[model samples]
Target: MVRIACLILALILPALVAADVADVYDFSDRAQEQRYRNLIAELRCPKCQNQNIADSNAPISKDMRDVVYRMMNDGASNEEIVESLVGRFGEFVRYKPEFDSRTFLLWATPAIAVFGGLLVVAGVVIRSRRSGSESPALSAEEKARVDKMLADQDRPS
Candidate 1:
């Protein structure tokens, strides 16, 4: 009887787990609900870099989803909603960052780093070729000494 009770409890335990998802939308129109899903998928969870608000377990993500749901219910446009979030959290909260003078560095930094690496590689290759092509100069006395050593070596075993 004790084993059967434990097995029943084990089977029922999974039913108690709750994800903090917002109430399912009962929008008069279907498109608005779709838009809400898309918007939540686009917004990054602040506490979790790799997860969107829809998929994140963080309370912040749940709160952000609630905000998005409320904004959609209030008839806010997608752009307006996104702008509100960006205004509060800066551009980092959005998966797609907007282009502006301030973000030029963010977009250009990787290309600049690649170009800098290529220049360094080219400089190293050029320097190595230059070094390898230069023959060491020998004094006449040094050449004579080298020749003498060769001659001695060749004379007998």
Candidate 2:
């Protein structure tokens, strides 16, 4: 009876402790709620680094969510909301950063890498083709000797 009580308590205690209470927000409509969701999903959590604000449980993420909600309530445009956050947190908060002078290299890196790979592949292909074409053909005497050796190998010891 004591063991059963201990087991039930142990299970219940962990479940209670592990369950996180989610933050609740009152939006005027479903569109506003969706916009809130999208904004949070697009914004990265500065404290969490790899996680978006929507997915992060960090204090900073909660604050950011609150700010987004307040801004939306005040009739701020999506661009205005994004700009405000970007101004406050720097461009690092945005999942898709604006293509500006600072971010040009970042956006161009994939293209540059692909072009470089193509050049390397072309060089290898050209080199292989050249080497293959330049190889001297075996002489008639050499072919005859190879055939003789093969015939000898086929014969019984």
Candidate 3:
């Protein structure tokens, strides 16, 4: 009976410990709640670089969500909330960073890479065409030797 009790407790203990407590915030209306949701979804978590604050379970994500809730209650606009977070955490916290001199290269990298690949492909094609067009002609002696080999193959012993 004690062993069975211990087994049950071991199974239930992990489930209790691994359970996440979701954040509960009271917004004035559905619109406010929705706006809060959108803002959190748009903001990337600093600790979990790939996940938005809304989807991340990191402690920093929870703090960020709290700040967003407080700011919304204070009647801050979405842009203002985003700018404040950006100011605090740098542009890395934004999933889609603003277009600027610093980010121009980031945005332009795909195009540059494609153009470079095309140039490499074009060079290969041009070189192949040039090399193929300049095939060396066989000398008279070589042609005669090839003809003799073909004639020998055609003759039965």
For candidate 2, the per-residue lDDT at 2 reads 100
Evaluated against the true structure, the overall lDDT of model 3 is 0.95
> What ranges in model 1 sit over 4 Å off?
1-22, 28-31, 145-157
The alpha-carbon lDDT assigned to residue 3 of candidate 2 equals 100
Task: List where candidate 2 sits over 4 angstroms from the true fold.
Answer: 1-21, 135-157
Rank list by TM-score? 3, 2, 1
Backbone clash pairs for candidate 2 read none
Off by over 4 Å in 3: 1-21, 138-157
The estimated TM-scores of all candidates read: 0.68, 0.72, 0.73
Instruction: Give residue 115's lDDT in candidate 1 (0 to 100).
Output: 100
Q: How do the candidates rank by lDDT, highest first?
A: 3, 2, 1
Model 1, span 71-144: residue lDDT tens: 98888999999899888877888887887898899889999999999999999999999999999999999999
Candidate 2: C-alpha lDDT:
0.94
What is the RMSD of candidate 1?
A: 5.0
Question: Which window of 10 residues has the lowest lDDT sum in candidate 2?
Answer: 129-138
| TM-score of model number 1 | 0.68
State the C-alpha lDDT per candidate. Answer: 0.87, 0.94, 0.95
